[model samples]
Target: MTTQMIIRLDSETKTKLTKLAQAEGKNTSQVVRELIEDYIQNRDMGSYIDDLWDRLGKKLKARNVGSREIERAIYESRASKK
Candidate 1:
């Protein structure tokens, strides 16, 4: 589900934004939505960590690492901390 958000911007800024948006072949709303999404993604630590793990998993997989190897590594790391 999506909702509408009303924001206040100075007239000059709005004009410039509209022109820029047009040049990029997008509407003001699309540009604003992308900016908001990027801002949230950058500030959201949980999302950052999830992305990090995903990249790590892909890299490990490319090197032929398996789930069992990952589990064993985790087990050894935890055991050493005790």
Candidate 2:
């Protein structure tokens, strides 16, 4: 099912959107729809951070780095700052 929406944009923003739509060979509606979809699909910060940490952990484990080593480094840095 399709629904119609009405949006109002300032003149500059409307001009920019029009140019972008023309450059991409899409109608303004298609560009606006894609932008709205992207805005809706973006990840929340906690999930984004968890994903980053998971990737970092995998890379660190591949290089044989352990949590204790990381903890000791953190402690040493904190101690030096004291």
Candidate 3:
């Protein structure tokens, strides 16, 4: 089932949107719907991204460092170079 709704835009915006829709071989509504959908999805995904970042940070902290004194080892390695 489908229902029709009306939207208002300034004339300059409408002209640009119409040309973009035509160039993409889609009607104005289809292009607008896709842009609106992407906007909504990106906004909604922010919380999920924060949770994933926390999980990744924990994993990185847990990973082993090869040498007991990492900074000293790096300075020694660098000094040995020509």
Candidate 4:
């Protein structure tokens, strides 16, 4: 069940969208739908970052690497650049 949406775009934006659609062999509506879906998926990036950090912590723990060691290595690396 899909609802029809009416949007207003300026001529230049509409033209660019139409060209992009044609280049991708899609209609403007399909391209717009895909772009909207991508935007929706990435909107909750905080949760994504938290999950990423959790996974990284588990991996580091398995390798016996503590956060203090990681911070020291980062500090050393930054100091070497100066």
Top candidate on lDDT is 1
* lDDT: the better of candidates 1 and 3: 1
Which digits, one per residue and each the tens of the lDDT, describe model 3 over residues 1-82?
8678799999999999999999999999999889977887778778679878788667756785434556777688999994
Give candidate 3's error at residue 36 in angstroms.
0.9
For residues 1-82, write the lDDT of model 4, one tens digit per residue. Answer: 9999999999999999999899999999999899888887688788679889999889999999988999999999999999
Give lDDT tens digits, candidate 2, residues 1-82. Answer: 9899999999999999899899989989999899887775574677678888999899989999998998998899999999
Candidate 4 Cα outliers beyond 4 Å, as residue runs: 45-82
Best-to-worst order by lDDT is 1, 4, 2, 3
Model 2, which residues run further than 4 Å from truth? Answer: 43-82
Over 1-82, each residue of candidate 1 has an lDDT whose tens digit, in order, gives: 9999999999999999999999999999999999999999999999999999999999999999999999999999999999
> What is the C-alpha local distance difference test score of candidate 2?
0.89
Question: Candidate 1: which pairs clash?
Answer: none
Which candidate leads in TM-score?
A: 1
Instruction: Give me the runs in candidate 3 sitting further than 4 Å from their true place.
Output: 46-82
What is the total number of backbone clashes in candidate 3? Answer: 0
Tell me which residue pairs clash in candidate 4.
none
**Each candidate: what lDDT?**
0.99, 0.89, 0.82, 0.93
